[model samples]
Target chain A: MKRIESLTNQWVKETKKLHKKKYRDITNQYILEGEHSVQEALENNGLIDCVITTDDGLLKYKSILSKVSEEQLVVVTDGILKQLSELPTPQEIIAIMKKSEELTGFGEKILVLDHVQDPGNVGTMIRTADAAGFDQVILSEGCVDVYQSKVQRALQGSQFHVSIVTNVALDKWIEQAKMRHILTVATALDDTAMSFKELQLTESIAIIMGNEGQGVSSDVLLHVDKKVYIPMKGQAESLNVAVAAGIVMFHF
Target chain B: MKRIESLTNQWVKETKKLHKKKYRDITNQYILEGEHSVQEALENNGLIDCVITTDDGLLKYKSILSKVSEEQLVVVTDGILKQLSELPTPQEIIAIMKKSEELTGFGEKILVLDHVQDPGNVGTMIRTADAAGFDQVILSEGCVDVYQSKVQRALQGSQFHVSIVTNVALDKWIEQAKMRHILTVATALDDTAMSFKELQLTESIAIIMGNEGQGVSSDVLLHVDKKVYIPMKGQAESLNVAVAAGIVMFHF
Candidate 1:
């Protein structure tokens, strides 16, 4: 275990830079803060590079530390942690974790979010995919950077619990997914799409949810085998895309 | 349409007061802005007292305004609109809309949120319920104020599209609901309750979703006829509560 006391410390500066998507991608690492998120990363045995904490960080995460290998622990001052965090109320603990590699052929379910710009929705979808027993959660390049602090917080450490990969070529990813016999069910309001309940999710499937405003891109739709709707019974034009995604994922 | 130009205008001062819950409640009026939200509100022939907008707002929403009564339109200066707005980047238009009455019905589905305080979730849930064709969306007293700007924005005028009532007494509402022969489903992690898919929601039903952290209160649970859960298939323990509700609402 090592200790960092200054915000100017090389590691602290590097950690702060990790907030940028280009930096995260280049380094193959991202920052996730919060006692729960840090603990989940360790407990799930996700790739954890180091742990950062204020004075109280260790106190709050003593249990998590025991679960993680001792060599991975890095303690830093509260000031250092604050400089490295994006949250208004900084968590006592933060973890440097490896970006998840592309995962395939996990199980019966997967999720593909096409250009979901809201980090809150992106993170919530990933978390839902994990809970619904989906094998993986895939993201198109246009979606918010999943490594952003807000997305990580919204995930509540589910980022470590699920298989997630981002910024890939959508058509290539779909091609890889199709090899595993994964059916892609996209959501659209058009008359051609069957109601969600009518779709058979019994086979390995990837449920595609699109942006809040602009819907599924035509390319993604072309890759999908079928289109579905949640069957709106009211005057409102649409459901929040994330909520709609959760509905389909749970049903599948 | 009368125009208000000064930030210090009496109407601007009064409208600014709406940022507080007391003023919003006492007046039974709240602020709504952004082209999309206002258009959604107007296109639906909502209970809007009047609209405040600049020339740009008029241009962006002219199509929607065509559906609104001319008597309810109020043109205002950009300065006045900024003073009335709470968002950093103020939309060109803001509307002072009258709140609807508490809903009482049994023939259609409904959603009751118990003490869920996050404005975004509360708003998203209301909007989601509206899209799902629920008869109404009820907010318990302790939940976030439905008329707040953040909730209003997140709702994206689903507030206008759906029947939303706040400050409700749970027992009475449930009693009125059950009298209509509606199923009341409370979601919990417990296994005995039917998996969300297994439950039938074809008839009148009241599905109660709880707070972000604490689930349906035992008090609310006592009133529900059945408990339901979105089955967990992976390492994650639970999905975000709102996402969970969205999934179940459609599946049922």
Candidate 2:
């Protein structure tokens, strides 16, 4: 197998750029680190451009490595792996996978995010939405780039399992969803909002989760058919955005 | 106000040591940082052993500082503040608060953790339990200290609002809960476990959440009156521990 020793090499330099959002968007590829994520990508038939592994990783992942094409496998030095990895203690294996194309048509249950910028929250919401059996997750333009490494880690390989569309116009999407006869529910701490426990699930529903500090924006609230709030019995100002999303997603 | 410039001072040394769990336990004190937590502690009538602030903090928090006794206030340099803080950008103010006495006599709804080691998860579970109107949270001996900086941050101001008992003997607590005629529910992914949706709540209940990787421990599960699993419909392995806790807490 060919080995990459020099960090100065064009391939190494390009792969290192995957750590940033701009580079990931430009190349339409993102780095998948750790054994679980790489294995998940392989199992999901992800479009893998290449696999980079340290000497330790080659032995550790010998079983999975056998499935990768000889040309697609490049063993790299620990130094090169460190330079490419986003983690403090870099994992030995990394896979370069093409971004999955966005899906069309909404599932019966949909989750929409409005300027919910934290990468961890974004990733967790996607994972929870998937587990809760939501059809699709659409993020507004102001949300963090879903391809960022922090998000990918929080997603725990569920990103590949779910349908996620980022940089969508949330207002326009909500209008379209309403046109499609989907019930739009806004989650906010407003006087007019009914308790989430009192919410009735329809055949088609789109749930909107808002920013950490701000509840759902007024424009989005205007488009929603109903507004519901999780009853807060304690002094906590608000629930963590991801936790709130999980509660709402699974309510049905 | 007395300004302490020397890090070698006995008070400074003692306060800095509170960052570690051993010192925190020995002194029965932990440093509460940032404006929100300090304010919450003040409002909640927490025992304020001392307050440390940088010049900027003293000026910024002058209104609140007026309420604290002159003897309890110590103005320190920014250097000392940095040394005392865990965040990269340290908060201007830090307060040393005495740990509250543990509560006895269980509330109607109690949440217990068994080896849920992640500080963020522990804190979030506590916050979610509070928001869901649970009466108290009991942490198993193996769980992370609730006073840890990360856990404090995750809890926001809710730490002061909730009754959290750490380092408890969970088995004994479960037995006592059963004796009190409280329904004991274990959250696990066992085949025989009923779906969480089908769970019937009792007037008084204690729900046990488990370790991130390992579900409910066998010993704890053995004592539970019922076992329930969140029904998952997607390819993701499982929901995040805190998310799972939130879903379960809100189910009632």
Candidate 3:
């Protein structure tokens, strides 16, 4: 196996750059840290560029490491690994993976996020969508990058199970979905909005959840067939964005 | 108003100690940062020991400050306020509040947590319970401290909306709740567990959520009247704890 001992090694320097969104976008690659995430990426046939680990990590994850090709494995010192990691303690293993191809088609159930900012909220919503059997997740232009480490940690490997499409024009997508006879619903509290419980389950549907503070954007709300609200019985003005998405997603 | 200009001032040093759980416990006081949280505590008649802010903060929150008595107000320099804040960018105002008294009576609906360790998860679940009109929340002994800054931020003032009981013994509480004729349901996937959808709504109910890694503790699970599971139709193994709590809370 190849080995890198120096923290200043050219390869180590380049790998560390993957921590930033700009670098990830430029290289079309991101890092997945920890044993579970690395194992999931490997099992899912994620396009892995390489795997980096220490000697201890190699022995600890021997069963998982057996799947990696010798050419794609690199041994590194603990110090080097920590320098490349986003975590404070750093994990035993980290995998460099290429971004998955954009999904072209939509399934029976779809989740659309418009300007949703929190990484944890975005990741949790994606995982919930997967559990709810949603086909695709569409992210509007202003949504947080799903490739960030925080979001990746929150996803817990659901990113591999569901299709995600980013940088979407929500209004255009809604119009296209409507033309295909798919019901598009936005969670909002406008005059025409009705309770989400009143919504009927449809064979093909898309549910749009908005930013944390704001409900669905006005322009996107104008394009959907229905605007629904989750009726809150207590003094809390609204539910957390991720929680609201889960309640709505599981209902159908 | 009293003025504190030095970060090392006796009062400033003492107030800063509230950031630690041990100190918070000793003094029975906690700090609430940011304008929204401080405002919520004030409006809800939270037991305020003092309101600490900079001259700029005082000017910015003039309307809100009008409610605070001169005796309970203190003006501090920007550096002093920063020293007391948890956030990197400290908000203008901070409030020192006494924890609410332990609730003696049970309500119609309750949410019980067993060893839920994540601060964000606990706070979000409490907020969700409030939004669902659940009457109270009981926290197991091993759960994260709700008074922690991270949990307080995630709560967004829901701590003031619902009655919260902390450091609870799950088995004992379950026995007491059962005696009161409340149906206790636990989220788990054991042999006796059934789909949550099959649960019949009762006049009074207590839903127990477990740790992020382990579902409800086996001891607590044995004590509940029913074991329910949220059925997942997709490839994801489980839902995020907070999201799962929201779905179940809203279901009834």
Q: For all the predictions, what are the DockQ values?
A: 0.76, 0.79, 0.90
Q: What's model 1's lDDT at B162? A: 66
Tell me the spans in candidate 1 whose CA falls farther than 4 Å from its real position.
Answer: A68-71, A104-108, B66-72, B104-107, B179-181, B200-202
For A133-230, candidate 3 gives per-residue lDDT tens digits of 99799999999999999999888888898899999988888888998899999999777999999999989999999999887899998889999999
What TM-scores do the predictions have? Answer: 0.91, 0.95, 0.98
Angstrom error of the Cα, residue B219, model 1: value is 2.5
Q: On residues B1-252, what C-alpha lDDT tens digit does candidate 1 reach at each position? A: 777677777877887899999998799888887778877766676678888778778888787667666777777877677778888889777778887665554436788899999988988888878777776787787999988888988888787766777788888888777887878888986656777777864677888998888888878777788988776877777777778778766664
Chain B TM-scores, listed for every candidate in order, come to 0.91, 0.96, 0.98
Per-model i-RMS in Å? Answer: 1.2, 0.9, 0.6
lDDT of 1 by residue, A1-252 (tens): 787787688877878899898998899898888878877777777788888775576777677777766687778877777788888878777888887675644446778888999988888888878877787787888889988888988888777666777776778877777787788788987878998778765678888888888889888888778999888877767788778877777775
Lowest lDDT block of 10, candidate 2 chain B: B153-162
Q: Which runs in model 3 stand beyond 4 Å of their true positions?
A: none
Q: Candidate 1 docking: what grade? A: medium
Local error of candidate 1 at B87, Å?
Answer: 2.7
The sequence of per-residue lDDT tens digits that candidate 3 reaches over residues B81-197 is 989999999988999999989886887999999999999999899999999999899999999999999999888889999999999988999999999999999999777899888
The best candidate by DockQ is 3
What TM-score would you give candidate 1 relative to the actual structure? Answer: 0.91
Comparing 1 and 3 on TM-score, the stronger one:
3
